[model samples]
Target: MNTAKQRKASLPERGFAWAAAFLLALFLVASLFSLLAVQVMTSAGLHTGTATNDSVLDGQMKIIHNYIGVLADAYGFEAETVRQSVSRDELRDFNLNAAAWWTGVLAEGESRTIPRWYSPAMEQAIRNAVDSAGTGEDPNVILAEITEKIDRTVYPLRESLLTTGLDFVNKRADIPGIVRSLRQVPPLCLVLCILAAGLIALLAAREVFSSLKYYGTALAGAGLVLAAAGIIYAVMQLKAMLSQASANLADEFGTMMHTLFLEAGGAAAVLLLAGFACLFIYRNRFEKHMAPGEEQAA
Candidate 1:
């Protein structure tokens, strides 16, 4: 009876187990929180907000914006111009042509800095047209001049308006939401603290379960999972980029990037915590596994 009583007293109460569990939980939660935050930002269209309407040394952005405006008009956006000035077919042509130009420019490494208000050819064409338009030509005459230049110079390339670009813009809008949530700072800090607590708890649990050798298995499994998540993320990113190039739905690509990079990363961290939890359980079990100093504490 005396020996049993002494051993029972020596064993830790429930508090130790609870603390370890809490730490492990926190670690997993923090990883997930980060993932969710990133996703929210991406979907809200804020990921590349800085890239919009900022100063352009050249008029490249203005041109792109103009194209966007034209596209919006084609979609029945009522502006100063009559809604029918550009037909849907015309818009499609413009979009296709612009995409081709962009692709070609990227291939040639000339896509980096958007040329100011005009490339050499565009500038020359515009100068000629504007000079004629300024001559107080009739409305039809002015339209004719502009149309001629556009047909001769712009229409020949692969300019086609498609819904793909619009879809990309629509999806990008969700990125702002994700960014807003992530930038809150306080919530993220809290999440980090929780994760830290979880890690500690997990370590404690490993100590408790030391006798079973479960910790080793847990760690090995965690390492593999983390590796897998990393690999998956990389593959997803590659796919997203390829889709961005080939498909019309740019927004979808952005979403995929967010999911694979942020969400998957969080999931992997959680897996790591599970491994730690196993370690803590192991540590609390077998005395032989403990270091000399820890053994004394036990």
Candidate 2:
């Protein structure tokens, strides 16, 4: 150890330094919250193209497709056969409507009608086709009857369903707002953190080494707290929220919430590690810069 001692800081100067440190701590805390919020929003609400795979939305979509198939079968139509006839554009429209149904459940106090995918006339015609499918009816005649019925009736019904679904999709996600929020929050957090650090540095210019340990310890403590909270929240969300709900839309919402909570928890853990690292670095090496009693001596 170099037996070197620095002169003490004035009482006013010491108070100002500690005050600046406190402000810095607050800024760091804000930064942590903002970072986690951004992740949660992006994961749950933004619905990026790549994020769609295996997401709650994807799961919800499967449920929707199954529902449509079931509805068609209830009306005596071959659901799989009909679905096979759907074009890419029609399929896209149907998906949008299904997603709309999913979105309503996620919003609190939001009531929306579940779409009836087929008209009564369409159902009746399909039943008629099913009834006349066999029973010694001329083979070509029966086939012709069924084909004509579907071309005139079934395809029209499908187009209407597609139109309805497209309308729902148009209403669901607010793209511009989501993009704006994502962009704004992180930069704001960064600015606050930088300003805080600068304030601390300015106040502690004379005792730079001594103040660093305090800063590191604050970071470590905040990070650990956030990490622990995040872990607990993640566990609770997985157990209580991730399970599929009785309704298809509710199940999709559960998935969305689960993913968001998980991401938030991860962010907290990263913040915690960063804080601990800061504490370790200062405690082990930078603490030596203070000489342990600079302010007291002055």
- If scored against the real structure, what TM-score would every candidate get? 0.32, 0.54
> What are the clash counts of all predictions, listed in order?
59, 3
Model 1: number of backbone collisions = 59
Candidate 2: stretches off by over 4 Å = 8-16, 35-45, 49-51, 55-58, 65-69, 83-186, 228-266, 286-298
Expressed as tens digits, the lDDT of each residue in 37-140 for candidate 1 is 44443332322221121231012223333553563334333222322343434433443444444433322322222211113333343345435445433333
Model 1: per-residue Cα lDDT at residue 113: 26
| Per-residue error (Å), model 1, residue 130 | 12
Error (Å) of candidate 2 at residue 41 is 5.9
Would you list the C-alpha lDDT of every candidate in the order shown?
A: 0.41, 0.51
Q: How well does candidate 2 score on lDDT at residue 167?
A: 55
Residue-by-residue lDDT tens digits, candidate 2, 70-111: 655444445554334434334344445544443443222133
